[model samples]
Target chain A: MKFLTPAQVTALMQDAVDAQGVDLGQIRAQLVLSPSERVDWLIAAVENLRAFRQKL
Target chain B: MTFDPRVICRILAEEGTEFVVIGGFAAAVRGSTVLTFDIDVVPDRERSNLEKLARALRRLNAQLRTGSEVLPLSINADFLDQMQVSLTLTTDFGDLDLVFQPAGPKASYADWADGADHVDLGNRLIVAIAALDDIIASKRAANRVKDQAALPALEALSEQIKSQT
Candidate 1:
């Protein structure tokens, strides 16, 4: 994946804060998942998305 | 620009672009399914084709970088001279990698519309992914520890295919 520019990351982070009612920091925390971890990476990714969108 | 990876694969296939499925989608195509967000294609031939591809991307406003710096928003062509390029796309959605299969006598291609069991992607075109049998061979040839770990599941799928055959 390409690196997100600092500005773009900040803007996206802000949007998540305004649109979802969760914490972006927590969501970012969950984005990293091992490909073969036995646990469901998709489920973890979803929670990350929710945590990212905690504004509304 | 914004296209579904499967759809893109089908289109490329129709355009006579020969490729093999890799990544999570390849596993899914082999029936040990997993969620895949990007298209992973390895061309049947490398070298000349890869050079042509590098020139094409050079014209597309893509900046090729190396080292600790992350890949730019488009394909990187700087490493093409080495033979194959592992093309990665990073979009607003996520990231996908399409690694070109290294060329020469060692290369192989998949057959589409094998007419037995097939899933039509669009326009009646199907994803002629590597057969379960071949996936086993490749994962073994890859020989990475992680890839080896996937061998049993792949072998099981191959066994199932053999039984069906």
Candidate 2:
């Protein structure tokens, strides 16, 4: 495998950090949901997580 | 068991137990894209309300959640009154946290309810949701590693809400 230069490695790390940072787009998408829909979304998400954890 | 907050909130409302939803779940209600596995609520400290909450808890079959094992919970008005900080419990609907005083300036249930946003969750089930600002303040005051991690997203969501309104 070709080794990346130090500067390239640093840039890649920064890009990874940026990817993990807060996504305003996702937040805005959630905001489009009504209060009740938001709650529904939360419940569904939690349920899915629980199922995934159980399988693990 | 599934983490069904609607069933949990419905039980509380049906029992006429007054409370304000808080913590990560409240953040999500306020449009934060955070995934909370449990429901956190600050219940009214009145004796009658505590009694109502006790009834609701019993209906949910709530038991104290412990690291080693789940302990049986004896929920009563006096028992709830003596709980100075918080209690974590597991119910059929999933995990539930009863927060007597959240870590923030507005510590009491009434204080949170005063500025809470009333959300109608359909089915004639309207519940009080702690304001996004209060949620952010409490998370800041909490300052836990997890809380700190969640703050950036929560703050961004709060700013977004403010910009709109």
Writing each residue's lDDT as its tens digit, candidate 2 over B42-87 gives 9999999999999999999999998789999888888988999999
Q: Give the number of the best model, judged by DockQ.
A: 2
List the lowest-lDDT window of 10 residues for candidate 2 chain B: B117-126
Docking class of 1: incorrect
Candidate 2: residue B91 Cα off by (Å): 0.7
Encode model 2's per-residue lDDT on A1-56: one tens digit a residue.
99999999999986665469789899999989988888888888877877898899
Q: Could you give the fnat of all candidates in order?
A: 0.02, 0.86
Q: For each candidate, what's the DockQ?
A: 0.03, 0.60
Clashes of 1: 6
TM per model? 0.49, 0.89
Interface RMSD of each: 14.7, 1.4
Instruction: State the C-alpha lDDT per candidate.
Output: 0.47, 0.89
Off by over 4 Å in 2: A1-19
Tens digits of per-residue lDDT, candidate 1, B112-137, equal: 11311344443556655545455555
Q: Which candidate's TM-score is highest?
A: 2
Q: What TM-score number comes out for model 2?
A: 0.89
